[model samples]
Target: MNDWTSGYVAEIGYTYDFFHAMTPTRMGLAALSKGVQHPFGRETFSYCELGCGQGFTANVIAAANPHIDVHAMDFNPAHIAEARALAEQGGVQNVHFYERSFADFAGSPGLPSEFDVIALHGILSWVSRDNQRLVYDFIAKHLKPGGVVYASFNTQPGWAAAMPMRRILTDHAERGTGPLEKRIDDAIAFAETLRKSGADFFANNPDQVTRLTKMRAMPRNYLAHEFFNKDWTPFHFADVAADMGQAKLDYLGAANLLDQMDELCMSKAQLEILDNECDQVRRESLRDVMLNEQFRADLFVKGGVPFTERGAVGAWFATPFALARRYSTGPVKMTWRGLEVDMAGLDYDPVLQKLSEGPATVRDLLAQGLFGAMQWADITRMMKYLVGAGFIVPCLPLDGIAERSEGCRQFNLAVCKQSEETQKLSFLASPVTGGGVAVDRMEQLFLLARSEGHETPESWALFAWQILAPQGQRLEQDGKVLETAEENIAVLQVRAQSFAARRVRILEQLGISLQPIATAQEASVASSAAA
Candidate 1:
């Protein structure tokens, strides 16, 4: 007999969170920020995700960008089934899910002949070396020219201290019997027992003890797939670059906009050293060392076209952007890598004030004289930091906004309906940004209520309470549970009011509708009355 999982976790499932970085619009923006030309301007393109667990991001991207065709595959039939069910329920078109391995997908006859973008997140370091090679081969064979590939993995130096802990857990779990979940719990308990017994490994590395404490609080499903896998290997940036080179893919940039800004993560001396490095691979390696990067979400392009300095700057300034959050006037602070950086002294107040009115490009701002005495370089840096910190986002091109809006509304409505049963789907498709927006379960319930003709926040709160009361769920305040029905409704009403005051405006600008969709019966009655 032979095992079919190939040493991967199959008893549990991956989380259903959406990754905005994997979306094409975000990838193109990151590439353009680095002065590289991407293929996103094409009228229509194909996208593929390898090892797409549950296919949440793929579904959201397809919904947000109706012009793009999406294909996603996973080896687990359960994952593929759930993905297909969600797509069907949402009435989403232009997306196809498959239950195929990396090797099988490379030779599959039913897939598109070529893809403009191939993306996989946190997949490389978790799979066996043979499977990783199959992924590379697939990209080499099917990725279109001038295409982009997004791959994320665990990095080496940052994981050096945690490697032994992972090995101990894997070894213990492999030796145990019965359900995999129980074995995982036993292995963690055993490690905790060792620590309590004054093991030298734990005594010498106090940080590992702290990490173990945090791990005790994390989801067991996440732990099972993340650490219990038989093949978990963290690689150096240079090695991964070489692997990508095998497929004729060149390192584009970090999928994260924040990672592109060196001052945020590096010191002056470190920056000087990195700036002096001529080779792209070597510089990226040194950068990882400087930041002690644990994981990386990187973009690579096949036969990339470099934009001239003038063209890059011109294109960036010409792109329109909108505020992602409520219009506020104050010093904006951001937390990165456990450090909170204050932007009070930065001259972003003027720009923020201008954007409060509506979406506009840098050129538009300049034409309005909002820059005053600031240089173009300073304005560019400000925009980069602001966008990277999530205060603002680039808007999608207006050419297909109507189509995107229709698809995203249907997908978001399906997600809102599903929120009653599960809170795992915490994002909604946005047509304006062409990406997913973080909208929590409670907010989703409120939105659904509004779409069902609940006019006021008070009514929205009552609708949500009715749903939660049956499930025996209550609101939590400062770690204390509000058990009474009145208490829950009060808290929910407060939240609904806040949502209506802030999130509603943002959603409207993103082309999301809060009005109800009339049923067929209602429409026919209205038609008869008119006649």
Candidate 2:
């Protein structure tokens, strides 16, 4: 193997927490689909991350969708081991981690074509050409009908700037004979000399120059791992489209949906000129306008599936208001549900209004509102209330609306509760703790019950009792211990009905089909038995 591939492999082995920070993206997608109607049943939804590394993204998805099974795999045995360990530590039971190469997966016999969504982040650019072909084939054979696959890779125009740097680093490595660290040091010295010579393209661009300078200042391992990757390839939009077509997948949308520059936004004359051009040319022209390089996240739908474009659901143009003038005072008058009200009087209205304009941090909202008295502590409570009310959402600021709409608070809470329950169940089933449920396990059970459907504190308490009843435990309420089977059945039935209603609403919102989990008669019998 080349030093570049060796270094890349070494880096993957050394950095165990690879892609953990990117977990929010997969989690956000799950949360966003909560109220949407999918053609597949909710429980049938599944996600697979190609080049999953240490399975950070897989763990996050499993945590978000306890009812849905997750599968994570990597060619590196060491990486898979680390991923499995992390999943076990996190008490995540929903994910099945495996050490298998793309080639092996492609050649495997009788593997079910089960995945609903396949994510390939930073994989296509780093893998060899044969591996890339295997990846495409795997997606083609494994992804279910109408499934969406997210593939992010390095793209052209941006790579125009990166290619020269790669060449410079490769030449420097060839001139040096030592450990990877010494070679990286020599490479950095060479880059600095070129920078001083002022004869390079990077030197002409201030941003690229700054980036190179900062990168050189980083650790030797970082430098060696990044610039010395052997199989790194940057492709154009047209080429990617053709590749996907070969794999029996059709481009549906961009994973970074907002970044897919709209032709409508261009001037009328420009739009008319581009209208005659091909899709590839239009896409390239748009990317040029955005100055995007390094990464392009495209979504592909399975071929032979009827996927009608939803025509931008819930898209709104934000009317920019002068924050300095409009929100400079304390308790400004705001319109809410048609009536004007003091923004401070109602706990969540002000926060909701700010979010409506666009997403803002609690600090940003406070600063914009010119609130001199209330601190973040006071504002946090109101923000939580707004999140509970489904007015405002919380998200990691990666891509604008993609993260916001998808990272729904209620859905996150549900997934979190389910994760906790799964973890507790795993522990209870383990040989340790004398095969008895731990206190923490019981607490998580109650939390899961509440999040699954129960609304009131009393309902949560009742659900908890029902869960504990199977283990010969009862709840003490109002100085009395109630352990009746009928009471347990009543609580279970009510909670199930409530959850079913919520699930229906979520399906309607997401435009997904809702399939009944059980018939009415079966549900009644199950509820009666539990009671």
| Top lDDT hit | 1
lDDT of 2 at 171: 78
Taking every candidate in turn, the Cα RMSD to the unseen true structure, in Å, is: 4.4, 16.6
Q: Candidate 1 clashing pairs? A: none
Candidate 1 residue runs with Cα over 4 Å from true position = 342-346, 514-531
**Best TM-score goes to which candidate?**
1
lDDT string for model 1 (1-531, tens) is 026678889988988989878977788889988788887766789999998998999999898888888999999899999999999987788899989988787666679989999999999999999999999999999999899999999997888888988888889989999888889889889899989999999999898999888888888888988898878989999999999999999999999988988877677999999999999999988888887888999999999999998888787777778888875777778898777765544578777777776778888888888777887767777777888888888877778876787788888899899999889899899888888899999989987887776667788789999999999888899999999998999999899888777777676666665343334234223323322
- Candidate 2 lDDT over residue span 277-390, tens digit each: 668546554654445455676667675343232411221111111111112124444333234433354454454445444445444655567334665444433433333223
Candidates in order, TM-scores: namely 0.94, 0.55
The CA lDDT at 301 in model 1 is 95
